[model samples]
Target: MILERIIPTVLSVRRILRADPALVKAYGGDPEKHTSLGLVTCDQDDAMYVALDEATKHAQVDVIFARSFYAGAAHASGRLSGEILGVIGATEPEAIENGLDALLRCLEHDACFYDADGKRTVTVFPHVIASLGEYLSKEAGLAPGTPMAYLVAPPIEATIGLDAALKAAEVRAVRVQPPPTETNFACAWLTGDLDACEAAAVAYAAAVVDVAAQPRR
Candidate 1:
C-alpha cells in the first residue's frame, strides 16, 4: 500500500441484520444472499468507491448503494453525514463485518487524494487497480480481474489528465464523467492490462501536476 496519501476518514459505521423490508428492497439487497447491511460514510466521496471495491474482495458482499452529497463534507447534511454514504449487503452479519473491515482498512491506508505539490492546494487522485474486484467490475461494466485506471480530479484537470493518460498507454475508456459532479469534480475509468493501466495512471498524475504547475499559457 502507498504510504503517502490524504486519507478519507470514515465518519460513521452501521450494520443492520434483518433490515426493514422496504429499506432492503430500496438498497437492492437480495433477501437470501443479502440479509445484512453494512453502511458507512466517508469525508471524500471518490475515496468511498475504492473502499467499497476493496470490501467486495474481502467478503461475500455486494455494494448495494453509494452516493455523494452535493458540495462536499463541508456542506454535509449532518455532522456524521460526510460527503458520501455507501452500503454493502451480505448473507449474514459476519460477512458484513469482514466487508466493513476492508472498507475501514482501505480508508485508513489507501485510496486517497495526493497533493500535487508540497506548497500548492492542487489535488488529484489517479489510481490503478491491478485486479478489479467484483463490485467495481460490475459498476464499470467490466470483467473481474481486469485492470482499471480510476482517475478523478477537479473538472478541468481530470479532463486534461485523462487525455494524457490515453495517449501514454494502450487503454480503453470504459467510462467518462464530465464536470458538475456532486463534489464538482470529473472522472474517467480506463481498462487495460495491469502495466498499461499503471502507465495510464502515472500519465494522468503527471498531466494533473503539469496543470497545477502552469495554470495558463
Candidate 2:
C-alpha cells in the first residue's frame, strides 16, 4: 500500500484580510482590493489540488501557490508540511474561511488516492469531475460544465495507466503532467462527456493494478 489512511489534514490560516502589500506583490498577487490567506498541507497532494479547484467554485478565491515537496509526505522537510503545501487567497476573511470549509468537505467525500485492487499495494487516484468548476476550467482550458477525469499515480504506473484510459474512452487529454513531477508522480487531466470520463477513470484504476502485478522473474 502506498499509504494507509492515517494521514491527517493540516490547515493554517493567517489573518491577512485586505492582504499585506509587500508580501502580496512579492508573491505576484495583485496590489488591489481585499484579500485573506490560507496555508494548507495535505498528505495526498493531488487530492488537495482538486479540493482547491472545488473551493474556487464555492467561494471567490484564487490558488496562490500549491506545491508538492520533493519525494512524499513521509520524508517531509518538517512537521505539518505534509506531502504538499497549497495556499489560497480571497477578498475577505470570511470568504477564505468558507473556501477552506469547502475544501475540507470535498476532500472528505470527493477526492483521495486509493489502492487499485481490494487490499492490494498498488496506488492510484482517478477522480471524475462531473462538472468543471472555475479553477479546474481554467486549468483544463475548457469551459465550465465539462466533465474531466483527473488521474494521478507514481511515474510508470501513471504513464501506462493514462494510455489505457485514453484508449478506453473518447476523451481528450487537456493537461498531462510528465514524469518527475514535483513529488515524482505523474498525472493527466482528461475532458469528455461524463460517461466517457467515468469510463476513463475505471480504465486508469485497472491499469494501475496491472502495472503493479508485473512479473519480475
Candidate 3:
C-alpha cells in the first residue's frame, strides 16, 4: 500500500475516509504521523492537473483529498484562477519533503503558490480543535441570552472589519470566513452581551464602507 496503512477506519470504503475523520479510528498508530497538508494555487486549470500528476509520480505519498478552484477567484483579466488544497501522507518525513520538492519543480516557471504545513513539526491541533468544539457547543460559555452578530463585507475589508468589531466592544470573535472572490463576501461572527453586539455590528458596517471607498489592489 502506498500509504503504508496509516489509519484504519470503521468503514471499509475509501470515500468515507475522506469525507469525515471523526468516524475514523487509529489502529494503535499516530493519526498525523508524517502527514502534511498543502494549498497550491495556479492561474490555469491545466497546470494544476499536471502538477498533481507529477507530484504523485515523484514521491510515495497518498493524496488524501484534492479539489480544484475550491476558494479561488477570477482574475481581473477575466480568467479563472484555480486552487488545489489537499493532504499528503507518507511513511517518512523525508518522503513528504521529496514529494513537495518534485511538485515545486513540476510547477517551475509557473505563477503559482505552494504552502505546506507539516503537522509533526508544528502542532496546533489541540488549540484549533478545542476552539471549534467551544464554538459548536450548545452551552457556549457565554452569558445566557447573549446575542451573536455576523458582519458581512467584501474580502478587502475582512481585516478592517474584524479589528473594528473588537475595538467597538467586549465581544468574542466567533469566526471569520474570508471571501474567495468579488462574488463571495467575507463574513465575521461576534458574540457578546446585547448592547455590545449592537455596537460591534455598527462598527463592522462602518469598516465595510470605509474599505469599499478605498482603491482596489
Candidate 2 C-alpha lDDT tens digits along 1-217:
5333322365443446666777776665665643577767878888888898888888888877777888887688887777887777877888888888988888778788887644635578888988888877887899987889999888888988999999999999999989888778899999889999999999997888777777241
Model 2 residue 5 distance off true place after TM-score fit, in angstroms? 7.2
* Number of backbone collisions per candidate: 0, 0, 0
Best by TM-score: 1
Ranking by lDDT: 1, 2, 3
Q: Tell me the spans in candidate 3 whose CA falls farther than 4 Å from its real position.
A: 1-144, 181-183
Given candidate 3, what's the lDDT at residue 121?
16
Candidate achieving higher lDDT, 2 or 3 = 2
- Give all candidates' CA lDDT scores: 0.87, 0.80, 0.44
Q: Give TM per candidate.
A: 0.94, 0.89, 0.34
Q: Give the poorly placed runs of model 1, Cα more than 4 Å off.
A: 1-4
State the lDDT of candidate 3 residue by residue for 41-64, as single tens digits.
444332343344445566775554
Error of 2 at 160 (Å): 1.7
